[model samples]
Target chain A: MSATTNHPMVRFEGVTKRYGALTVLDDLNLEVGRGEKVAIIGPSGSGKTTVLRMLMTLERIDGGVIWVDGEPMTHMQKNGQMVPAEPKHLRRVRSKIGMVFQHFNLFPHMTALANCTEAPMTVLGLPRREAEERAAELLNMVGLGDKKGHYPAQLSGGQQQRVAIARALAMRPKIMLFDEVTSALDPELCGEVLQVIRKLGSEHDLTMLMVTHQMGFAKEFADRVCFFYQGKICEQGEPKELFTAPKNERTQQFLRAVLEAV
Target chain B: MGMFSLSAMLVAALIAIAIMSLFGDNALFMSGLLQGAWLTVQITLLGSLLAVIMATTAALFRLYGAPPLRWLAVTYVEFFRGTSALVQLFWLFFVLPLFGISMDPFSVGVLGLGLNIGAYGAEVVRGAVQGVHRGQWEATTALNMTRWQALKRIILPQAFVAMIPPWGNLFIELLKSTALVSLITMSDLTFRAKTINDTTMQTIPIFTLALLTYLVMSLTITIGMRWLERASLRGMVRGRGR
Candidate 1:
């Protein structure tokens, strides 16, 4: 919580991730300051999602290390040398981050209220009454207060996604990663989920990293937009500058393709 | 509508008349058969409880235990599934006594039937658990839940619904398999029926009565399991309306 301005909230230092010979992220280095809203945009296979996933600790790093809050995330110092982190170390670091997925992976067996409260009660050791109170507040914030008792199957894709966001926020994570959260929703429904995220972006001091296909939202909401291509950030800048005037040819081509599709 | 189905009422009346007529000639014999049938029920109930426990343990070992424990589970499942149930019963009843492990006939019957059916039930458990969507696991991990907590709270409850129907089949199979316990001198339904057959020399009537008794027990299991399945899935939206 006492993050100094000099130290970025999240830093990827020469981070490399690979699946056999296919490198998903190649010696990538990036940094996000506290409360910065960064959007990642790219064509499929560009490794935009991989960057968010690695930061969430959902994927293993092939080489190099990631730093969160100035501490190494993918490794721990052993005998003055960096070594791959143990599961205990990973869990301790991972508690600081929360992620929302494209599919809105809400537990279908649980009600929306239960889904939001589960992590707080079980993972954070909060008393049930306190967890329920916090979960109710989060559900209300996400505009699903009335639907708290409903199961995921009873909710629309947008509602489910919104509940997923609430569920993540209930943990009070320092960093929130959104991986194309609205991609699976219908065009009309995307607005509601995006609006909730927008409200959070403006109202909270939480650092946000998003991988999204919604270029318009990215332009409006992102402090900085990073354009990824072939597992590297080809270009990045303030949203207005990056979208309107691109210095990289790949970025220009990708934006044209995406805009034409829309 | 009446309290009972018309067909069920008709069946019940016919059974009462038949029993009354049959009772006049075979009163003592009918009473003896009823005692045997009660013993059969007792064995079935105890065996099923044991089978469920063994199957869950074996399935968990197969799914999440260390490599050596997994191998042990696989070996146990394959051995019991591959061998004949009758042979298994005979081995437990006849062979174990030779090794200074003398179990009573009733204990042998329960152990053999339970272990045999549990092996098949173990496969059912494994399939249901694995059938749970991969997204559920990812969701649990994202919530920072440990593997044990996830399995207990999310995965297993979902798997329970999928497991019920197949487990019903295994339960009935176990019930039918209990008849084999008669060979080891257990005074269950089949044993009593055989003893009566020896005395009365009325093969058709005695065996027919035994067959009907087994049918009634099997039907009860089917109906009871259906109720259990519905109760377990009561809150979930997918199967609720149906």
Candidate 2:
């Protein structure tokens, strides 16, 4: 199969975000090429999660624009003017992007199958039977085919996160964002979820942006590794060069602390 | 003057007897008490049903409707909670004619009782709906649910479990409030006792029956509410999954 194309699937142009007085993302300019797997690593407060959250539309940007598949994500351009994304515009753009949250915020009342099928039936207007069939296939891919009838509480944290990944993927989204998908799982359970994600990165041609602390997975699965510090990309390169020989001092310091802790 | 304190002293002793036995006497006095108690239960059951419906609709309007409808909900709740039940009962039974609307004494009694308890019930309902977790909202939004869909399928089902306790308390209070409906000529428990007192010339025995009847009504409501709570919470436990 062919690799990523030169065209960008996701791009942020001078994007900035703030919460009250604190600036969480400061004028970030980044792009993920079509069908590429990019891993973002950073210290605790380095805003890696914010980048993924922005792509998910869970948080809004304070300034600048984000483009997805050559269309602006946060707004629509009309007559050379940028306007707030109308409901229709947002729905169209959002349908192409899918997100798996850090906490696996599954609907506690729904079984795993229902969780995966809800959006397809509701937003995509798919029939219930069709949605369920698609959901079953996605569940099998995530190694959760038999757990489809179980509620979120009946599953372990790792199982719930894996189900969340299937739920995000069921939409057949062109781009996927994973924000700390394994951070909430136990150390022993993290590997299974990480393995599923690594399998997705290789098997699917979809573009993915992942924020994680798993250095080994980042080095193994990512086409590019970005080390972020203080809301800025401090260093970015091939995973081997960035992890073993990062050019920036801040990147090295952050890596040293993360490595020592594990 | 000597007769007044004498009767008061005698009634005080009867009050002590009433408290000690909890009015469980099986004598003729208890027979009169039970007849009155039955009427009280009838009024409370019907009145509380009306109250719960009104309270739930008002709470929904306050939480989901436009600003004007929300204001109307607020105004309705405040008007009932602000006025005494006696005054409201009087207004419903007597003053409704100014607008050319008239109803029977029983209808007025139910309306007065319902309107009064409904005010308190609305606050309870509002609090229950707000008690749903914030993360639930996020999950619903991520699924692209409309606001009404989120409220119906996700929020309100969770809120129903929380609303029952406060609603049960209001039901007990409603049992007592039905006594005010007697002044409007409904012949509820308090009215029955007053009629017996006039004909039998035995004020102590009649009023004592009324007190026992009120106790029975309140106890029945309390027990029934506990049963309903258990039934409703069973469903909630299944959703929460232990």
Candidate 3:
């Protein structure tokens, strides 16, 4: 639908990943337009998170390339041949991207404000005063301004995850990757993180690629949804259309299982 | 109680008092022993400093360097740990001259004590580093931090706290091991005791003072380590944060 959204913000061209004999992702291809929220849904071990991990460079592609803002990321052109991107160049390209992991991955030793400020001050080279001011703003945006001085162990899982979202945002990334950000939270705490994410998606005009199991949130929040199975996208389409009337039998089965589990 | 049991208890208690008085007395022999023990304390302090620097280097090389460097780290750790420190100290003092490398007595003593403890300290440093949660690596990498930056700013600070307990244990061991350096004619505490015994013809008194000084040094280090541990670990538990 929509003819693949010309000049996509994030594009994967025949990406593949393998863990020795396992083949975690097999010749996968996808595209997300600028400022679009796309959710990936699948059973455990279905390569759903692998897609996000690859974009974040936590996992490298076994074959093919990824383009962010229309520039190649997985490989660099060297001697007129595509080679694996060098670490230095890869870091520069990756700085434009941000990721929030399932476990919240907050720096345990730092307070929430310090966590938000660290990347800005260290990686972005912002002055301490400026970074602290921006971190305060981010904390307020995530509705955790009061918890800024608290370490991760002092915060609830949901609160820590929201801070992690704020930390990712502090980098001012063009593309944000969420790898099951809510799956680690308790049912009662999940709403707060999801709410912050939904607000960011609407207010910031951010490009987002998320892996989540909250079918209702995915249906309401994402512009498009992709259903993955056995290391490949089984089906992908507009959220409203895909959830209500899936084109693939696998997607229908997955939706039924997820809904029943919920 | 019977006289035999009562007397036996009295004898044990007197021995303890005698040991205590050896450290506290103002006798000529006590002062002589203390001067010798001072040498041991100084040697141990210098040796521990060398251990800290060398162990940190060995651990970093093993973690970040090329295969040859890593192999060298592993070899260094195993070599010193595998053999007795006495042999290494003796070999350094005696054999290296064949290859035209001769260090002074004090340097040899410090080097020997340092390298012996460095082997064990390297393992402690390595474990503490790798023990950090893998999530830290991902978070730092996501921020696009250079490897060294991540280690210095994010990883090593936490690792340093984790390392203190093992380092304390190493300090105590290093203190005890410094006595070995006296064999190289370093005039360390043990060597000083021998020198005094030769001059004053008082073996038991000099040795008793040497033992008490060592005990004091070890106890001081133990208390210091406990204090360091508490200070470093302070904010880890909630409700205690200042």
Clashing pairs in 3: none
The best candidate by TM-score is 1
Model 1 spans with C-alpha error above 4 angstroms = A1-5, B1-27, B238-242
DockQ (C-alpha based) per candidate is 0.40, 0.22, 0.34
lDDT of 1 by residue, B47-161 (tens): 9998999899999999999999999999999999999999999999889989999999999989999999999999999999998877778777778888898999988888898
A170 Cα displacement, candidate 1 (Å): 1.3
DockQ of 1: 0.40
TM-score order, best first, reads 1, 3, 2
Query: What would the per-residue lDDT of candidate 3 be over residues A1-262, giving only the tens digit for each residue?
Result: 3454467888999899999999999998898889989999999999999898889888878898998877788888899998889987798889889999898878777889998999899888999999999999999999999998988888888888989999999999989999998887889999999999989988997899999988999999999999999999999999989999998999899888877886
Ranking by lDDT: 1, 3, 2
| Per-residue alpha-carbon lDDT of candidate 2 for residues A1-262, written as tens digits (9 for 90 to 100) | 1454455899999999999999999999999998889999998888998898777777889999999888797989899999978867776788888888778877666789988998788767899999999999999998999999988878888898998889888888888888888887889999889989888888989898999988999999999998888999988999999988888999888889888988
As a whole number from 0 to 100, the lDDT of residue B57 in candidate 1 is 92
- For candidate 1, lDDT tens digit of each residue in A1-262? 4646579999999989999999999889999999999999999999999998888777888888899988988899999999999888888898889999998878777899999999899989999999999999999999999998998888888999999999999989999999999988889999999999999999999999999999999999999999999999999999999999999999999989987887
lDDT against true structure, model 2: 0.81
Which pairs clash (backbone N, Cα, C closer than 3 Å) in model 1? none
Task: State TM-scores per candidate.
Answer: 0.93, 0.81, 0.91
